[model samples]
Target: MTHQTLPTGSVSPEQAAREQSLVDEVVASFAGAESPRLRELMEALARHVHAFVRETRLTEEEWAAAIEFLTAVGHITDDKRQEFILLSDALGLSMQTITVNNEAVGAATEATVFGPFFVEGAPRIELGGDLAFGAKGQPCWVEGTVTDTEGRPLPGARIEVWEADEDGFYDVQYGDGRTAARAHLFTDDNGAYRFWAVTPTPYPIPHDGPVGQMLQAVGRSPMRASHLHFMVSAEGQRTLVTHIFVAGDDYLTHDSVFGVRDSLVRDFALQPAGTPTPDGRDLGDTEWTRTRFDIVLAPAQTASTS
Candidate 1:
């Protein structure tokens, strides 16, 4: 929209202004929406959206392209693919929503965007069991403890873990629904959990749809940081959805999904081969890395119920 300066009293932008005002009145027509909150939200949404179009003087061609882009986004959504969530992550809206909806739960673990790859009903593994089905990355031993905000151990806490492998591919991406590089486990009496899995590596978000074109048009890369995801829950405490990013990953500062946090970044230390694993897994002198992540959960009512 060109801001043309006209001589004072020369001409009035009556047509454009009237169109914007008419849109507002149409929104006002919905003031009788059954729920007060819904009505309020709808009105606000309409006002801002309308204002944006008026302020930008959006072209009909641009609006038509937007409609086509949105249609492609919807067309690509499915049981295994979530194009909408990917879009939200790309726009940083997911992280913004997380920040706003979560209250100060007295120094509990900070939440991050739950990526589009999470799947339910992952096979349960015993303590110290291996989560890698066929991933070929270097072995990584992840150890963690579940504790309450007050530092009390939470025994039997359900800990679900998933991540992409060294090659930057999650199990679900194969489209076979295979269970690998992901598992669900429970904390022991001492509030500790351990598992054998591949080290996480930087990966590109799926970008073969309209999102890919959108990124190309905006000059943005789709690479995400290397990290392992963990979702911890207990009987009476709030669930913690977080990840541990590789401390020195190049993409950590530029994660496409904007899920990285300073507190969540940690070291994945390399250990000499033949070092015995805590779970008594016989690696037969194989080299492996280790990472320890301690999770703190607040009471269910104090935190966002994710």
Candidate 2:
């Protein structure tokens, strides 16, 4: 194709420069137009997006496809799920953002992505109660304590936990009530907690969407290492959303979302069956897994201090 350059005299150099000035003026017009933080975010986003377009020499075709991909992502969202969040996970953006915002708070626990599968109002159960809801898998005895940075027990910390079954699928993902994998529990006076559940298995992220296409294009797998999600909170302490990843899982070093942290990796010890629970229920004759983890939280920082 033959290209036609702009006529030499069609526009003056000053006019071209003025066009660039208009771009800045348009963006600046939005500054101070809303909440201060929002204004700053908008301005920075605009600057970076514009810079990216220029730096990449983005073409109309590429831009149109990008828009279409985003539109499809929006279409895939619903009350119980968010496709954009999945996209963020697949691209490692969600984990990166969380890590950036969670700079260590004096030995406080690390925070990780609250993935797309979280549902509010999980059933509340006492420490050591079963979260398995009678599902079949490698029984796991999970025990832990909630404490402050100074090692003081947090008597009433609430710990919300969830994980996949032996087949690597959440309860909600496998139809209603097929499993009971989500539970909420509170720390006792000694800050001790425990629960019985199935040992989590490594699973693949949903790879039936645009995110999957992108992963395939890059020759990346969509699998996440075995892990259990925990959201723990207590009065006067900062809430922490994190995961206890199984150490030595094949996918740990190559977590699709980059959510693995050395501090979060834990050993799941295999225990012979007949392990007795304090409640006197024989943990059956099947082999099980056991793990113990502790959570330490930082004092809540006010918005100004944060």
lDDT of 2 at 24: 74
**Candidate 1 Cα outliers beyond 4 Å, as residue runs:** 1-20, 304-306
Candidate 1 C-alpha lDDT tens digits along 161-238: 999978888887787867788889999999999889888889999899888789889988899999999889998997
What's the true lDDT of residue 13 in model 2? 65
Q: How many clashes (backbone N, Cα, C below 3 Å) per candidate? A: 0, 0
The alpha-carbon lDDT assigned to residue 248 of candidate 1 equals 93
Over the full model, what C-alpha lDDT does candidate 1 score relative to the true structure? 0.84
> Which has the greatest TM-score?
1
Tell me the RMSD of model 1 versus the true structure.
4.2
Model 2: CA > 4 A from native:
1-23, 177-179, 274-281, 302-306
Candidate lDDT scores, in order, read 0.84, 0.81
